[model samples]
Target: MTEKNPSQKTVSSRQNIRKWLLIISFLLIPVTIFYISPIVAMMGAGKGIVTSAILLYILLFVVSLVVARLWCGWLCPMGAWQEICSPIFKHTVADGWRNWIKYGVTVLLFAMLAFTFISAGGIHAVDPFFGTVNGISITSFQILMIVVIIFLIIFAAAFFTGRRGFCHVLCPIAGLMVAGRKIRNLIGWPALQLDTAAGHCIDCKKCSNECPMGLDVNGMVRQGDMENADCILCASCADACPKGAITYGWKKK
Candidate 1:
């Protein structure tokens, strides 16, 4: 009997995990909004929920620092929605330029904060997801429904053009999460690499195909450069490697 390739097996495992995570997020969203949205509203109304909301936000921030946007990948409802659309539009390209959206989102958030502190407290109205979800009454959520439709459409376009572009570029929560990851040493940064003759990589290009980001994973592996900021630590490249030589770890200091 022929032995199965380890790299292919790894890729399959990672893809399975991604699929299951997406499914779990779909099931978890309603409960999350039911439990958390009220607390947010109460906090805004100065009804003692302020402390609870603050605590919750802090806890989430700490979690982000530790896991580096893993929540965005695995738990966020919008993320799950986007991932569901990814496979439907398969023409993707790696566009590192899209990272510029992070800076724009940061600026926009600060602008909202300034407006909230100085003028009418309407910052929440501008957050697309928040606005969409809470804009109308539960019985009359046409606006929110429309927003969802638009979001799904845009996500589908991005997925077909470039997978996960929405999260990498357009999502404000992801911007915040990425910032938190940069400022903290509390969470260990996961690094992926190979231990053996990395330079021998023949550029078979399987890793890039497997990567959600459409990154040159094979090139990075050849250069032993696993610490690239673009790396999501999903281990897709390791899964796609035909050679069992690919691995992930802390580089020797």
Candidate 2:
């Protein structure tokens, strides 16, 4: 086997760091569940909706307006889980009209939240650790079951559909991020984005193949349209490209 070059080693080290960071974040999900749980956010302590998840999502959306879904790429436990299972199903999910499903789900979830709040006469209290037991997620058998079922569905979706299938088709949080990204784009704000130099591309499809989100990175590079709402900003394409055709940069201009 040929010895790896220094640049390859550097890229490999960065990829490993990103992977381990995601794994560590995913491992801490049980503790951070209270802050990210949709159920707990939607249904409060038998009174009104919990404010933690809502506040967390709001913060995420604000971040997305500037960074464009970095939360999904770097910190989301569900994204980490799907990536861990990518070896089992490395197929690219077909992106078409089907991608609209997540938006519909987001709308439905918002509608439900609104109805719940209205029924309860608006949010009455704020409990960051609403469903959690002493700030831990899996305290009781019931909570454990709920967590198990959620993971089961996530796993099933990734196993059958493709890489980050649930994120593409089902995650309401993704829809929210997309909305934030769209608003940023419309306003032409300086935001985190993938910058590509199509002239440097050597037709190597490694970037596209290595993309965890299964985006057509090669095509995007060729078209000089590197900004996609679906892009999670993982920078896998940048690392995988040998020619340094792709890069992560802010769209400041």
Candidate 3:
């Protein structure tokens, strides 16, 4: 056999590394949000974790721009929850309901964003994870705990039964993040794309099955479409690809 292209192999290895790191991050986000630091320390200066300062949200935007939703894919606790569900539930129409929930959540996030701009508390109130983690009231804490339990159960059930259920259907945060990325598609950072020519996909449907957001990764690749802006970029699709068709790139556009 001819010598392996070292650079190509290196890139593939890096892609695999990022994929696994995203999974690790998924496990870490919730712990960090709840226990470590409600808001992760940014590369730049910042004071309060969740302040009314537009700068904080702006900082989030910059982070998203730089990482291109990799945070959602790898480090979001909620995403991890869904990814856990993927192995539990086989792909089904039930997942369709969960996937559609994002539309309603998308509206909700925009509504909160607008209200927060006016009332200041709107965004904070609707962020379920944030509310659950940092609530001051005992009743609120109980509610958050219940919500967390419900999501956990959903994840566990989905895990045993089939594929992702909660994240694809009920996760408001995933919906919000996807909507934000769609509104600003050019992430201006490194990203992974499914390349058609690689034909690496064996059409095993693992990517679709593994997707916490419940996207049709194989179909999207075959159609030459990457319109599913909600993609977590978890690299589950890339990981499952047998032919190595899915590749990482700074920008496919």
Candidate 4:
């Protein structure tokens, strides 16, 4: 057999690196969730106003303003879990009104936070490690069971709805990121995005097939509309496209 070209090998290597990075992030979730869970933050917020989880969400939103949901692709443990389930259920999500579910969940969550803070008189105290047992998430059997149940729900969403279905339908954090990304787009700020050259496309559907979010990447490329709100800027399409038609780039306006 002939040797693989260097550029193709490079793309493959990058894709593998991305996968490993996501896996590493997934492995770290047992620790990370102690500092990132909205549920925990909300519980703390009910007693006080500021917590590590709230701060983490804020940081993620700020990063999303520049990177457009990169957290969902590169760092989210939930995304990693859903992807790990892809082998058993490689389902495609249909484009429809179901996409509004996340928005509703986000709005409700924000409303709850507002009510809780208002009832508490707002910012009375701060505890970065609130709701966590000495900064550890799995401190008890009950907590471990809760975490397991949460992961099961996320996996079930992916299995039933499609790849990354929880991100598409139920993740309040995704809604927050989408809002930040939209703000960046509206402000014409330089941000991470996909750049496509339709002329180089060979009509192969690899991009769509490889998309973890189940987006219509091939149609987007053919129509020269590569800026998708749902896109996580993962660049899997860029790595999969044999024609080198798609690329990740920083775009202003």
Candidate 5:
């Protein structure tokens, strides 16, 4: 009977809390749908109105320009849903075709949205409740069906591809944030990102194993190149590292 290594066994309180937070966010989708709905964004664009979801997308882009993809790790209900389904398969998603999917989606969706907005005359009004049912989502059977199918797609993505598959493969929001992060990197601005002290690493590999995004945190540390656009700055690696080799902060990277 061999004991499990602490590095292999430990799931830190920080990560547990983050998982719970994301789960809670998922549960709150009914109340939050209008604020994050991609469909609403398109509808709003066509109406020449700025919807909550449209504003949210803009905010997400701006925030990512400052802090990378914190929204993906912190408050995205879709991300939370993926986290819930990831454990069912418990594997890394294929990094080939799937990884490029979001980029294409982002470009196509944004182009269509921009076209609609421009054709519709652009920014005529602002409506936080653009497509909501008296300020709440899921107000009808038809709406419920659409919502269910969206969630089902999210579920299928994670179950089949494993570990935040929708995020890597199909999230337009993720594509937006990735673009923002790239811009930030190019600008060399002070922003929120992971910092590493390679000298402090002892090659435990716990950081790599603990990442919910399936990132190579250990490799990033060893290479001293921690500025990955995919990194959500969730700090799971920071919490998992016993030697405090990895941390997150606001600085030029």
Candidate 6:
């Protein structure tokens, strides 16, 4: 039997940290769900109020300037839920024309938001607690059912399709972060970005296999480029690299 590489062990340990963090995030969904929900945002917008979700969408874009889709990687309850189901469904989702569908969803969501605000004469108030009862989201049986249905949809996407299938093709919030990250790339800011030392790679393919987003990390490394809109900066490739070929660093490009 081949011995385990120390670097591989280190990466595996790091991934475990991410796993536990995701689990904690998932457990806290009841408290945090409304805050990150676009549905809540639209509801608030219709009543001429700015919701927490609106603020978070803005924050996601702003933070993506420095961190890319770190929220998707480390703290998203839905992402955590999908990963929990990943043990039984370890397939990779495809990034095709369907992947672009989320942008249209984002546009429609925001367009409705804008229309609502306009109909209400624009921003009559700002209430981060607009949709919550004492900042708790699943406050009633109806709400609990909604949450359950949403989670079931997320689970269905992951189960019937592949890992992060919802994220890759259906998530409405990802567009904001992707835009921010792309702008950062254009602006050349020293943000949280990945780097690859192709010379250090040995074609073991562990990085590609470890990528939760189902990216071609091995191909990215071979090309000496780790920049991708879909990359959540989870560092799975970096951690899984037995040769330390992939690494994360704060820099542009």
TM-score, every prediction: 0.68, 0.93, 0.60, 0.94, 0.90, 0.94
**Cα error of candidate 5 at position 129, Å:** 1.0
Poorly placed runs, candidate 2 (over 4 Å): 1-11
lDDT of 4 by residue, 64-178 (tens): 8899888888778888888878887677777887777998898888888888888888878778877766677777889889999999999888788888889888898788899
Lowest-sum lDDT 10-residue window in model 1: 123-132
Give per-residue CA lDDT, model 5, range 62-102, as digits (tens). Answer: 88898888988988999888777765758877657778888
* lDDT (Cα) of model 3: 0.51
RMSD of each: 6.0, 2.4, 7.3, 2.1, 3.3, 1.9
Better of 5 and 6 by TM-score: 6
Q: Better model by lDDT, 1 or 3?
A: 1
Please identify model 4 stretches exceeding 4 Å from their true place: 1-6
Per-residue lDDT over 1-253 for candidate 1, one digit per residue giving the tens place of the 0 to 100 score: 3334556765677669877987786666543442324224333433212223333445556775655566665556666776676676465555566767756875675454444434544333312123224432232366347446656765854664577766666654555556666664344454222343575556677777876666777777767765444456566666666664466444331
Give all candidates' CA lDDT scores: 0.55, 0.83, 0.51, 0.83, 0.83, 0.86
Off by over 4 Å in 3: 1-31, 34-61, 65-68, 92-98, 109-150, 153-162, 184-192, 198-214
Order of candidate numbers by lDDT, starting with the best: 6, 4, 5, 2, 1, 3
lDDT of 2 by residue, 130-203 (tens): 77778887777777788879988998887777888888888888889999988998898798898988988887
Higher TM-score: candidate 2 or 4? 4
Candidate 2: 10-residue stretch with minimal lDDT: 1-10
Candidate 2 at 35: error in angstroms? 1.7
lDDT tens per residue, model 6, 1-253: 3334467776678788899999999999989999998889988998999999999899898999999999999989998998787777677877678678878888888889999999989999999988889888888999989999999998887776677888888899888889898898888879998998899788889888878877889999999888988899898989878778877878756
Q: Distance from true position, residue 250, model 5, in Å? A: 1.8
Tens-place lDDT per residue, model 3, 104-135, is: 86467546445444543223322223323353
* lDDT, residue 17, candidate 5: 74
Worst 10-residue lDDT window for candidate 3 reads: 36-45
Instruction: Report the alpha-carbon TM-score of model 4 versus the true structure.
Output: 0.94
When sorted by TM-score, best at the front, the candidate numbers are 4, 6, 2, 5, 1, 3
